[model samples]
Target: MAPHTHIKSVHTLSPIDPWWKRNLVTYHPTPKKSRHIKVPWWSRKCAAALQAKRHAFAAWRKNPTPPLRQRFHYLEAQCKRVILDEKRLAWASFCASLSFSISVSQAWSFFRKMVHPQPPLTFQ
Candidate 1:
């Protein structure tokens, strides 16, 4: 095996290059007039009133209604109980269905054996 030698070269960009001219020096047009326009007073007042109404509604919602909360909690608990009951019922139904299928298969095998009896052979 022989030893390998590697060489590297460095490249420099020129000032007169098209890339330098395009990137380093670019022209942008000045705005002829100001872009910002003043909002009308009526619109501002309406926006303020809408904001106030939203704040009032938010405050109203933040103060919890005790009766409503109690009712909601009660209903939620009932729903949980119902869901548990439904799961138990579903498991029972599944067990019943599995037992019924097993019984049906056994009954079918017995009926097939009874209907088709094998003949006996006698040798001389």
Candidate 2:
């Protein structure tokens, strides 16, 4: 056989390439229902403590030093304590408000909300 004179082109595009380039992918937004349920025990103080604990954790993670780790632990304990205290107080107040006059449906509604709160959906 004679010497082959074959050549290959690297920059060749297929016929369907133009169709893919011309049509853009689009996404439609999904509608969601908003839930405005309120927690009886959550407060601004708890939020602040939790934020501080998160910051301390970030600092500890960045440096991994003993001091920072200790600080993070302390903040974590403090945050837990504050949350527990707030919950206890809320529970106490709720117990104090209990009476024979309260309707069964209203009490059950409160219990339902407290026991199984529906979290908002995130578009992750």
The candidate maximizing lDDT is 2
**TM-scores of the models, in the given order?**
0.30, 0.60
Query: Model 1 Cα displacement at 111 (Å)?
Result: 33
Q: List, residue by residue over 48-88, the lDDT tens digit for candidate 1.
A: 44444445445546776776556555554554454345445
How high is the CA lDDT of each candidate model? 0.42, 0.69
Superposed on all Cα atoms, model 1 deviates from the true structure by an RMSD in Å of: 32.3
> Candidate 2, residues 1-124: lDDT per residue as tens digits?
3422441321243454554323322232335656656667777887788888989999999899999999999999998898778778877887899999999998887666555443212211
The number of the candidate with the highest TM-score is 2
User: Candidate 2, residue 84: CA error in Å?
Assistant: 0.6
Per-model RMSD to reference:
32.3, 14.5
Where does model 1 exceed 4 Å of error? 1-63, 99-124
Output the worst ten-in-a-row residue range by lDDT, candidate 2.
2-11
Look at candidate 2 and tell me the lDDT of residue 35: 64
